[model samples]
Target: MLDVEVSSLGPGVIERALGCLRNGHHAETDVPYATLSSLLERAVEAQASDVHLVPGYPATFRIHGELAPVDGEALAPGDVRRMVEAILPERVRGRLETERNFDCSVAVSSGGQSHRFRANVYLAQGNWCACLRHVPTEIPTLEWLGFPDALAARLASHSNGLVIVTGVTGSGKTSTLAALVSLLRRDASLRILTIEEPIEYLHPVQGGSMVTQREVGRDVDSFADGLKYGLRQDPDVILVGEIRDRETAQMALSAAETGHLILTTLHTRDAKGALTRLVDLFPQDQQDDVRSQLALSLRSIVCQHLLPSAQPGQRRALALEVLHNNLAVQVAIRTGKIETIESAIQTGKREGMFLLDEDLQRLVSAGQVTLETARRYASDPAAIKATKPAW
Candidate 1:
């Protein structure tokens, strides 16, 4: 059922768990805990991005951009349910049994090292299933994430406005946002507040910043409600984990307009897509108002992608498209001429703006990635090919 490894989750988190699982419903008489634990250790050793446990299928690990099966027998349905229940709270366990879905994060400490994961557990075709994304303990800096230090600083320099990190799922949005927060906390004595679901990376009290983190469902009912209360909490900078709904988006925009630096994530592919998603979130009657509000408070949008690295054992390479709001960007957003914003970005490279395709081409030229790989993930394959280095 729930595959938490003993060494991984540490003594306090799972001591009573094994005993409970031993007497669990499944016919598993032997301690099945080691089965899940060994799998996790192997995943970490392989530098995997995610781990998956699905009934009727062997345990799977996602390495780089590919998923591969590990050595293991397919678990029975009852065993899957039992494994999931071991770590879930009683209320969540009941909900999972009834509703068959939930999202949560887990932390494991083993061999004197700590590891965290962001996970979503659900039912698949009447079988229990879960996918877990690994979160590293040591937070990386902007330089480590492959962003220009100057541009990163400019984005974090905003005292009051909206800054968004947009990307698809598993595109490293959480890591980049944490890096920005870590960098900001280094010297600024600002009051930073974050509302996350299961809180990915912890930002403790730094020398100059008072960092407070709250989780959704656990600490707050929802992001929208959290923002409403967060505004009244006297926070200098607020972090909304993700603005999926219109209410949360509206509250985030309002917070930005009302003199608070708001950082958040969106599942848009690029800079222009981020703009479109914001206005399209509202109904037709409110589109114009949202456009205006977004235009006024939009400080920057950083869209990123992780490309497979050519070097053996090296991590993924980050390609980003940065759009810092300027006179032209503001005009395009407010006037509903967002399609024209691309040319502005291309010509605004001197002002720290760049296209995603151009950045991919840079990686190809640097020999860090192949031209084929670059073109595969590029916004425009033709554009990327036109600038391909003669290798």
Candidate 2:
């Protein structure tokens, strides 16, 4: 069971308490606290992407996109609840009964290194269960995240417009946005502001770039409110965690048009879908205006996926469909002919546009991923074989 005193402490004190107990230092915590920390340590050591704690199962780790159960007895409902409560901060714990499903992140110290994990805890069959994904402490460079140097440079060079990184869940979209912020941080003159739900990556004020990060539940009420107030903060670059609602999409577009560089994310299968998704967030009367705003203020959309790699040691390869807002794309957006955007991407190779299928074929040709793997992820599997590998 969780220690009553530890459960009421703030997140920092809870982290320290867990660290001391995990290191075998004498503390007042109980077995559940130690068990939770130990499991996180093991998951990090094994390089697992996520950890799952559900009733009737031993602790499970997702390694290289495969779930592997640890060698142990299955946890009971009480055991899982106790372990989860050990890490929940008092602020979140107070609202658990009211908000049964929520997301939060924790930082743990293991082997003298700090590891962060984004956790989603919810009720299943009236019992508590949790899913935690490991987040790296260090921000990787854009080039390190597999963007070509030319493309990386182009992404960082944007002064004021909407730059979106779109992908499905667990496809490394957050990391890409954080890396872009890190890239912009190199310029000390820029002031960057980011609003995230549960604030995953904490940006230090390194390189003299001013970065202010705000969490949704903790710092603000919602993404729209965050953006509404964030504009008055006088920021050069603003990163909204995700554009989930119409208010957020409107505010993000407005910010981009008003000379603020807006970096955000959306959930879409491919680049063309991203364009449609944004405009569809509003009613019929507003979509035309939104499309005009997008055509004027949009910069680029990077739609990417993580394909299970065939190469030894490497776990996954990134397949990307990049759409830069060139003249044809702008015309298509302004004229409401979204279907023509794909043809524009196909012909705009000289303008640094590439289709996702082309990237998948490139990966397959380079032996980074199997042909079957590429086919599984391609939007059009027939187009997979039609494209040459050079893009």
Best of the candidates, lDDT? 2
Please give, for residues 49-99, the per-residue lDDT of candidate 2 as tens digits.
999999888789988887899876676665666677666776777666787
**Candidate 1 weakest lDDT stretch, 10 residues:** 9-18
The window of 10 residues in a row where model 2 has the poorest summed lDDT is 1-10
lDDT of 1 by residue, 49-101 (tens): 99988877777899987788876456556555666555554445666756777
How many residue pairs clash in all the candidates, one count each? 6, 0
Relative to the true structure, how large is the alpha-carbon lDDT of every model? 0.80, 0.83
Which lDDT value does model 2 have at 144? 79
Model 2: pairs clashing at backbone N, Cα or C within 3 Å: none
lDDT of 2 at 201: 78
Candidate 1 runs further than 4 Å off = 1-30, 386-391
